[model samples]
Target: MSNIEYQFSEDFAREMDKKDPLAGFRNEFLFPQINGNPAIYFCGNSLGLQPKNTKAYIDKELQNWSELAVDGHFEGEDAWMYIRQKSKPALAEIVGAHTHEVVAMNNLTSNLHFLLVSFFQPKGKRNKIICEAGAFPSDQYALESQVKFHGLNPDEVIVELAPRQGEHTLRTEDIINKIEEVGEELALVMMGGIQYYSGQLFDMKSITEAAHKIDAYCGFDLAHAMGNAPLSLHDWNVDFATWCSYKYLNSGPGNISGIFVHERFADNADLPRFAGWWGHDEGQRFLMEKGFIPMHGADGWQVANSNVLALAAHQASLDLFQKAGIKNLRKKSEILTGYLEFLIEQISGESGVLEIITPRSPSERGCQLSLLIHKGGKAVFDSWYGKGVVGDWRNPNVIRLAPTPMYNSFTDVYQFGRILEQSLAEFA
Candidate 1:
């Protein structure tokens, strides 16, 4: 991974693409139509392109629902009873967690709330939850509501970790320093695994170590990092984490998300969690006992029946993940994103009116680059879109372009760079 042998030339890029194991994967996705051919879609950070098989997978569930009546639960092509279980192993491989440690369940924010119920217990003088400031709005709301639900004021209970003066990204040292300096007052350390806006991949292992040192539980919002980067949640000793699959995992919009509960918590049968019938022991669930006997592991966290359509769509995308190993995807990501960084640099130099807010090092970031438009704002980005270059614009000045390895390629990067260069020229 040191100094990748990048073939920046168009011919070399095509030649490299010819040999890429994942080259054919691009065709498996349902592309957005643009003059018949697909548009240069580089917006996987916002919403992933749908897998072509997603519709077929979802249709199977619909077929069952239409034909099987109530018998679909036990007699369908794939039983609805164990629908979510189909995603566990694929998700485990993606996040480097044990299959027993993962479960496909509610959306990201909902799962965050559920995990917070069990993990974010604040007591005594240790009621503060430390997190990165300006987190994704849903995460922000979840944290605020959870803190306030404990009858604690958010202003006092939620400790925000911010970057230094005039800086856009938080450093590892700064975060660890705050955790250490906070001492025994921190009830939990919950932060984004990769900050959404800045695209910074935080030091999960070190952060967890620091939090545990002070007797605090550590958790992460892996919405932006789960499928984009390599994860070893179990080895890192992360207490709990939640993620959405629609973004980098390419599971389509509003798909059912996944959760990771450490083995320690999994084994803690005495732990407090909000339970439901779906969380009950499968063997006795049909017996409908008066008392709750929850499942042994992460399966115990589910509340209601599985979202079969969404889970099937998730399964469709995760099937691709299982084929293109996370390790392999991440390796290509570093290079693909590196190529993006390189192309963006050329654009910046040529344009002289754009700046990338993301880090220069691939190790410190993921597939995304948050580009700050200089002088020009949303209008410039709109112009780029008009030129058939599709990257997402976030509010006042930032544009987020993610060159995902699953489907994005060197040619796409080149096209985007060329569009950016021309767009800026047109503006000037």
Candidate 2:
């Protein structure tokens, strides 16, 4: 809870929009238009709108490739070979990590598998992994496959923590107790920093500390948390973390992902990993040496050459992130997302059809608010969608609306409220 008094009137929302420091950023994106106007795009938790400058960034690279051909890897303004290096500083700033600690690499699930290969070290009694019950499907698959690869049964080695009966989110105390209970058997604690379905932001620092106290490695799938929340991966002493760039980062869909490995394990030559030539030492990389001399930091986790065009798109969004400063963006996010929550409450007033599953505290969530729709389910969501309120609907009955600070505004959230009221009146 914040001190700001939220009101339901459109005038109040417009006033907030007028005062927003980040309001100019909304114009920087190419929105999905509705009836000649931009749609109420509260879906950054799924896919962010393209930055208006994305085309220029990508075109520069295409030009460089055409002119330089094989020499482009060394000669361009952002050389193909060093393209990942150029994006590292901004990425590090976004995630609160050192320059060498973070790298833009493969997609989310691929990075998860790669990180697990090195970090999910199960030995003797320490063979179990803990994750949330309804973690994103890809994470579930990665964890299960990793466990099976070790000749362990996922059912026996994977401990899924779920919310208590009738509860919407996991209690931090319960999570701490579970970590302590698992004690010697816990090999890794892997979960989302911000849960994808319920939009609950887990206490990552506390969770990391708890796991460490029990001698267990801790990591996060930060796909939903990356550009939406403030992270201190290095300060938190998180073991390793990975995230996709397409969501709140405003990178295009299926764009490159990012990874963070704490400084302690980054330079450890003895750490077992699945390596490739790109992860080789840059100087010796061209030698094609038989031995894989891994690079000293997160780059060592890379399995192939940089995805040039994908990186161009990613870098364009990261430039905005650098200019906007994550701390400032987070401050505005709290207010805008809070406004959305307040509006939802107003629309659902005394109505039993919809209930917010996301936490009420501003500190315990990102930009997204997940609504559990009890009646009309998909039809209610469809009505809102038809009205151009572009939120994401999950299975059974969850509609997630995220007013991303980088490009979303108070007026956008306000318009979503208007359409939501109409949707409920007609369907629920």
Tens digit of per-residue lDDT, candidate 1, span 225-323: 988988999999999999999998888888888899988777575677888889888899999878877687788888988988889889999999989
Model 1 earns a TM-score of: 0.96
Q: How many clashing residue pairs, candidate 1? A: 0
Estimated TM-score for each candidate: 0.96, 0.98
How many clashes does each candidate structure show, in the order listed?
0, 0
- Model 2, 1-428: lDDT tens digits are 35789988889888988888878888899989767777888888899999999999999999998899999999967889898988999989988999999999999999999999998999999999999999999999999999999999999999999999999999999998999999999999999999999999999999999999989999999999998999999999999999999999989998999899998987787898999989999999998879888898898899999999999999899999998999999999888888888888888887877999999998899989999988898898888877888889999899988989988878788888888787777766
For model 1, what is the alpha-carbon lDDT of residue 152?
92
Which regions of candidate 2 are displaced past 4 Å?
A: 1-3
Residue 202, model 2: lDDT of: 95
Off by over 4 Å in 1: 1-8, 35-37
What is the model-wide C-alpha lDDT for candidate 1?
0.86
Best by lDDT: 2
